[model samples]
Target: MALTLRHGVFMAPFHALEEDPTMCIHRDLELCEWLDRLGFDEAWIGEHHSAGFETIASPELFIAHAAAITQRLRFGTGVVSLPYHNPLMVANRLIQLDHQTRGRVMFGAGPGLLASDAMMLGIDPSTQRDRMLQALDVILRLFRGEVVTETTEWYTLVNARAHLLPYTRPHPEVSVASAVSPSGGRAAGRYDLSMLCVAAADGAAFDALAANWEIACRIAAEHGRSMDPARLRIVAPMHIAETREQARENVRFGFRKYIDYFNNNSPGRFPVPAGTDPVDWFVEKKLGVVGTPDDAIAMIERLQGQQGEFGVFLQQTHDWADWEGTKRSYELYARYVMPHFRGTNAARVASYQWVGENNVEFSGKRQAAVEAMFRKHEAEMARSGGGS
Candidate 1:
């Protein structure tokens, strides 16, 4: 059976240091509007305070702004670093966004991604995961209308309850970020939340994808909660054009700066050996697609073969290409790649085949009808001449 899949961008909006930050943000908003026009299902905006490149400080604020300009594209806080904010505030902010967007919001929780982000807040890196779990528990309880009063080493929640219930039933859809570690899977299972495989492009992460999902399913079973594959999202990087060469050429505009950001600033280092052509290295490693729509389709099929089925495939947004080229890349994906996976063209394909298969018989009948009309005209002319 063909599966219904949703497509979107995971915009940890990577901009070069040379670019103006103000213009970069506006372009990011424009990208969301572009996506909405192209019929994208959603956009997951990142929240980062430190990494300069991934510049959105507040995903919720960005979502509010983006949502107002667009009509139907849903938004997720690619993740709100749960350990960074108070649980009450996190729950309240999302609930308000839920109502504000009329339920076009999703709550994606994670242990903070950047060590520098944690360091700035005086949070111990080692305790971040545990803190995320604890904070999430409180948030979920509050969402359920439970007045939660809990004390923990990091913080204490006293008689806390959300004044406004979520516009979404039960609550806005909740998801947790999963990379190489099992912590995300464990948390997702325990809480029955969706899983966002953020590092699905990494080799180790790709290898562990199925196992982590199994862990989620096993834990869910133990808790009497079943995990839905429809809620599982796998994210990877991609940039496509009319041809593979053109795609590679497009990335040359800003790929080096993106590579620099990852190799130096990000904790999850991208190991591109010196003297290796970054484009060749990236594609050879199967880290992402820097090719045409066919390449993107193949990559998605490869992922499906490895992990079975999933809900969404979020393109890891990058400044690999120039603005126009970048927009074209997404346009190509929307025009060709999406329909291949979505089976959107199935009916049209079937209709064309049906016409082709019956053309001989239909043509013969059409010719016969024309000949009969000609015969009728000649007979009427003869009868009128005889009467005259």
Candidate 2:
């Protein structure tokens, strides 16, 4: 069987917090609606409680609202930051969402990133990963209808069971977030879940790409679970336009804002020199693909060639282009990019050519056969003395 790539977007929904709160959220919903109309596969909303620019605090709520506005587009929490909430509630809430969305939910769990958010919750950043693993373990058990009775430092559940099961055939697909880390891979392997590599475009993360999956597979072997490369997804930022120049010019507006947001909030992680061409900085950093639709296709194809089999290519969303430009990028992807990998458009073309080539010969033979039949009938009539 041939591998086909699925397209999705990973939206942090970044907007300056002071910006019109109403309009920001409305735009996020509109993004999902646009994706559904464009026949995209999925949209995963990010969760962040503290960061002023990274607005969406509850991705589940946003997913629920987006689910109503769109059809056939699956939604995920993007990473619910498992350490902050109780395991039972997380399990129950996700299961309920699966039912509500008719199984169109994919659970992507992670040890929350923002240290300030963890500090506010009184969670030690050092121990958060351990807590996340503990919570995820209990949640997985609860999902399987097994009663969980455990007392961890953060929370306790007494024989908790989820009577309300998921609508998906086993359960909605579960994924663990990895940022060039072995811990995320181990958790994914242990739970037999999908792996969502969040910073695939970052140079360091890209270097660790092959090693991370190897770690997951090794751990999975120890746990008697065979890892599937198709369950791995790599995410990157991209935008498409009519030409490279247009794409380069279009991303400058929000590209600068995006760089500024990071430098101001999480200093040193993404440092951009002042007054540099945003497009040059973008390309030099290997941050993402910004070119024509064909360029986007080549970017993904090259990644696949290097990384081997992976399931989905999730484009990171930023307000890089104006509204129409952003939507056109997605349209270009669905129109020119996706069909190439899926082999759908190529198949249609081949089928039409086959019909076109055979039709004339088929018609000519049928006409000759019909004429012969009439001639034979007329001859028989003349021989019987009934000829005109």
Clashing pairs in 1: none
Q: Candidate 2 at 40: error in angstroms? A: 0.7
Q: Estimate each model's TM-score.
A: 0.97, 0.89
lDDT of 1 by residue, 1-388 (tens): 5468889999988888889999999999999999999999999999899878988999999999999999999999999999999999999999999999999999999998889999999999999999999999999999999999899887888899999999999999999999988999999999999999998978899999999999999999999999999899999999999988999999999887888898777544778887989889889999999999999999998998899999999999999999999999999999998899889999999999999999999999999999999999889989899456
What global local distance difference test value does model 1 have? 0.93
- Residue range 196-250, candidate 2, lDDT tens digits: 9988878788888888888899999999989888788889989899899999888
lDDT of each: 0.93, 0.87
Q: How many residue pairs collide in each prediction?
A: 0, 0
- Worst 10-residue lDDT window for candidate 1 reads 262-271
After TM-score superposition, what is the CA distance of residue 348 in candidate 2 from its true location, in Å?
A: 3.6
User: Which number leads on TM-score?
Assistant: 1
lDDT assessment of candidate 2: 0.87
